[model samples]
Target: MLVPSCENDGGDSKIDIQYGAVINIQKSSSSDTYINLVALQNGGDINLGFTIDKAVGDITSMDVVGLYIKSDGTTIFKGKFSTGIKTFPYTLNINKQKIYDAFTQLNSSDDFETGDQLTISAELTLKDGTVLKLINDDGSNNFSSNIASSSTYKVFQAYNVSCPSELGGTYEFTTTNVKAPTGESAPGPLTGTVTFEDQGGGIYNISDASFGGWTGLYGSGNIARNVQLKDICNKISYFGVDQYDEVFTFSNLVVNGNKISFHWENDYGEYGDTTLKRTDGSNWPALTL
Candidate 1:
């Protein structure tokens, strides 16, 4: 009888793994994440500091650039920074003059406005001449899931341009017109007291966006309370959805003295025109659509 026997063979399989460098951000270095236009005009600067993680790869040097992302999805290359970095930990002190100069180089006549964003990204060069970037040219991430999930590994930093806003207070709301979903005219001439609570960053929470018009037509429980107003550089706009999951749009907005009058219509054919007057005798800022 022939017995089949198995012999152990020394065979092995190996996998090669590559690791990239990471930018460990120190969030405590930057106080605010948005650029205050008022402060920038007053000679303020954007401060950001980070360190390269040498534990992953042999990173020799890093080059960083600034990008201006407009509100209309337009991206412009601002300029590169003179980091003068010779060590792992680096601090970037970007002054307002540098930003202004970069913007002027692109468009001398245009100025930085609200609703714009500024992003700083970097490219790391390895000792073997391999360059690694965490952000793509189109402002997208190029890191893997594991790297993206790391809290300290930051690819880029962005700051939004905004103006100081203080439009929150008590107001007298007067409804001039109201229309139901059936296109039939509803009861108008509604008046009430509303409150605009400041939520910071140019956002205000209205007590009732419809200003008692929806309550008069649909009752108190059905009135819209989830409406918000955004004031970016005095440009007023609507935010959030109503109780019925309908989005609202404002039109014919006029600001005169201490009064703000506008016409609002929802996606479901509900519309109302209301005038809000400040009850505290404070003059409202010049607001536009």
Candidate 2:
């Protein structure tokens, strides 16, 4: 009789799962999430919006905070952006005046330099006196891997300080002393016209990276057309692969008024020194590196 009483019940066993709250980024004014230095200097605002998901929790209120992270990795607590916010969705209009005030409160003498970042996060208070937040006191994330990996569960947003790029136009490209793979002179000085088409956010689509040297060495059909240039806060660099899947390296970058000159080499042992001058009679903004 005791052994017969060990029969299973008809009801199914279940495990209940509860999820914590999350901050979902709804929209951003800048697609690249950058705070334009030129616009900030001209009295513009940093605009973004987010929504709080309750996620099976009883949330009473939330406090939004900001942290200013310098380029050297120093983190400064800029203090709360909003306290006791009971709203589900909120829009942030961060102006230069508010940023300046925060810096002043911290007694920091540093300006809002390029490459610095401003991160926004929040602290949520539940009905049972429980506080939940993504960031810790030491300016580090304290959340689960599942929440961190969720694209829709964005707990924080970082906006970088960037300079406005205006380096898109037609340029007269000149290449000299191009060398082949065997270290032999493949071509003499070659001159041509190239276009710097703006692709936004300091990126430009160059008409050609070889500056007619590839056409001189190979045929016109083998010219590098997929080459791209990046001007990050005046630092110039090359990226993107050529048709042969070879990467390009750049050096000796010098910017003089309306002219930009640099030395470039590819993985195939081909190299050249090139100079580019704007044909619109407009001087390029001061650049370095």
Candidate 3:
């Protein structure tokens, strides 16, 4: 818990200062097919943000600290703000190379694996050299508190993973043309079969996609697809090459059990929805295309 702002108790007035940090995970947008993760070995960059709420004194600089610990209480990585933060709601983009160095320093570990947890903490340095640390009831600044909202995050190696189990096998699909340009023929009820091949780690590849008579923007061919399951919002994403050999991506799909549906629009203002159902009980071998 953070100590509430208090001033003037014994006739001596002192400024109350509060600060904290938040780990921001990038959210997927309509244009984003997958969320990218900074590989531990290859090294990547991620943004770290901070919040400074109450401060009576002039805050000169704030130092943010982070540590990546393993299950054995070993500090695999330790990183800090190379310089003082000069502004509020400050965000720092940290490179994974620095993290790799920290890991090498600990046990000479060359690489990282999944399930690595990272704990971050922060402190404030006032202009007059007054240092205020994140305070907790236990006198530890490791965990998140009202003063500093620190947090631990689990590391994932891959990004843009699709649902492997439920998506595999063949599915019957029905597509209806919802909107089309003026003088364009509105598509009628279309039916087809789409075979999904599991590519491991929640990835699937779709081939032999036939949408009746309605030709897709990509010409009704094979498409690479993935999915991102958020807290409540889920999307079935598609990536393919068009007739012009240009790459395209479309998402905002809803999947319920054996049924999957999505709506898409191109730059030409053509749009429609395709609903899919798995009537055939077929589960292909994992990672076999």
Candidate 4:
């Protein structure tokens, strides 16, 4: 269980509209326990909080408060509030079983594969029977439309994950095969040999990088800076500065054995998908620090 502090927004002097609600997800102290597939399966808990400001009357009872997934309009877990907050602050807890059930519904079947998303969000019903919706000016109780998008919904993909092993080696990869979007030509098929070094703990250092006839992805003593991961097959978390010092990040990558394909975008707003396959590393120079 987690306890998070919340602050209520100052309300107007109006009579009827006395309370306003805001929900927040608390950050876990331990990074490892921060909402993962394994933890949810083992009955992990989600910590949540809210604040009700300028109550005209004491909050005697709350009808309902819970964590929900907007995708299927399902409420996986409901929180319990033993006593109402006669004041301004309150917290809630969502059990792991709720989250696990939601994910299981998303998966639709027994097998967990890549691209299955866990879309988590919060919902609550006040004592006056008003259901909260996170919209600009939606006063309708029939909330057929105000759900949050999957990107901002604490999204995580389910994959057949395995530990990184024997993946270290030098390989030549070609970038010319990338199919550009409509009205754009390919990146002109540049080939370069890059190295992947296992740094343990699911982290891999990528270096000696180059793509599309450009160099410097790992330069300026920055060979170890571009750390990526064979994280949970089909899910790649990448962060680094290229040789030109332009920052880029990769996500939703598909890794099939020695091959990798990903959607990448840079700080300048340029983005594309690049696919790479392992080539014979026997003739490639050994990785240098």
The reply for model 1, stretches above 4 Å from the true place, is: 1-34, 46-69, 74-111, 117-160, 183-185
Per-residue alpha-carbon lDDT of candidate 3 for residues 1-289, written as tens digits (9 for 90 to 100): 2334658879887877554332222222322222123232334333333233323345677666555654354534555644477766454343345445444443322444333444444566766675755432232453333323223321111233122134556678787764445535446566777666754333456553323323533445433233221210123334343333333234556656666666655454556677777776543222121
Residue-level error in angstroms, candidate 3, position 252 = 6.0
Model 4 worst lDDT run, 10 consecutive residues: 153-162
Which pairs clash in the backbone of model 3?
162-202
Q: Which ten residues in a row have the lowest lDDT in candidate 3?
A: 154-163
Off by over 4 Å in 4: 1-21, 31-121, 124-130, 135-174, 178-182, 190-273, 276-289
lDDT (Cα, tens digit) per residue for candidate 4, span 1-289: 1112345558644333334343333323332222343433444433322232322222333322223223133333233233343433433343444344434343322232322322222244456765543321221121221211222222111112122234566665655433323333345454666667764323456773333323223123433234353443323455346545556566555655556655655554444555566765322112111
TM-score of each: 0.57, 0.52, 0.34, 0.34
Which pairs of residues collide in model 4? Answer: 176-189, 216-243, 217-243
Model 2 lDDT tens row, 131-243: 87757656787666556557556777766677777888878888987888875565557888888787655668888888877876775655777788776687667757776
Cα RMSDs of all predictions? 11.7, 11.2, 15.8, 12.2
What is candidate 1's lDDT per residue for 60-93, written digit by digit as tens? Answer: 8877667777777666655667443447766655
| Strongest candidate by TM-score | 1
- lDDT of model 3 at position 138: 31
Clashes (N, CA, C under 3 Å) per candidate: 0, 0, 1, 3
Of the pair 1 and 4, which is ahead by TM-score? 1
Residue 113 local lDDT, model 1: 69
The global Cα lDDT (0 to 1) of model 3 is 0.44
List the global CA lDDT of all models: 0.70, 0.70, 0.44, 0.38
- In terms of TM-score, how similar is model 4 to the real structure? 0.34
Candidate 2: Cα lDDT at 87: 76
